[model samples]
Target: MPISRDDVLHVARLARLALTEDEVERLTHELADIVEAVGIVAELDLEGVPPTSHPRGLVNVMDDDEPRPPLPLEDVLANAPDHEGNLFRVPAWRQ
Candidate 1:
């Protein structure tokens, strides 16, 4: 069941896309080929193979969470473009 040029037009209409005639022609052949190629994957026999939760083995590579000595307040605020008291100063949003 290869999709036709009209099928592409119908899909574009359904998606509210405004495709040129050339785009419709291009997508018709490309989408049809993609669908046909995907059909080949259905022929694979994977009945006995266990379904994997993740394609690649999952692992957590994280450092243990631990508190550290805090940086000096002056050192933290030293590089700020604008600061008021202990907070970074920003543009006022409301009058």
Candidate 2:
């Protein structure tokens, strides 16, 4: 399938792009090549192939969840530049 100049113009318009004549001409050829490549791939026979999200299997490598002692309030606030009571102080956000 070949992409035309009109097709490129339409796509550019839909994408809200301001393309020059040279850019439109270049994209026409590039898009046509991409369409041809995709067409070739579509001709492949994969009837026996199973659908999968990932080609290789995925496994969780994270450590098991375990309860741990909490850090001391003084130790946690040691590096804080601005703190109120036991919590870090931050500027209020405005809408």
Candidate 3:
């Protein structure tokens, strides 16, 4: 389907975009090309083909979990400009 200038303008307005005349003209043609490409894909014959999320099987490789020593409290608080005890302190927010 061909995309119209008004269609492009409507989309831009919905997106809160302030498009220039040149940009609107460019996007009108670009969006039409994209729609035509999608139409071509929609015409493909896949009657016997199974729907898939991916073309190939996926496998996740994860490292074994191991216990580790925690960083010292002083080391963790070293970079804090303002801290109360072991926690970083920030300005209180007002409702």
Q: Would you list the C-alpha lDDT of every candidate in the order shown?
A: 0.90, 0.89, 0.90
Q: What digit string (tens of lDDT, one per residue) describes model 3 on residues 1-95?
A: 78999999999999989999999999999999988887887777999988788668666758789988999999999999989998999988755
Per-candidate TM-score against the hidden true structure: 0.43, 0.45, 0.44
**lDDT by residue for model 1 over 1-95, one digit each (tens)?**
78988889888999989999889988998999899988897788988988778869677769989999999999999999999899999988777
RMSD of 3: 8.0
Which lDDT value does model 2 have at 56? 82
Could you tell me the TM-score of candidate 1?
0.43
lDDT, residue 5, model 3: 97
Deviation in angstroms for 72 in model 1? 35
Model 1 weakest 10-residue run by lDDT: 52-61
TM-score of model 2 vs. true structure: 0.45
Off by over 4 Å in 1: 44-95
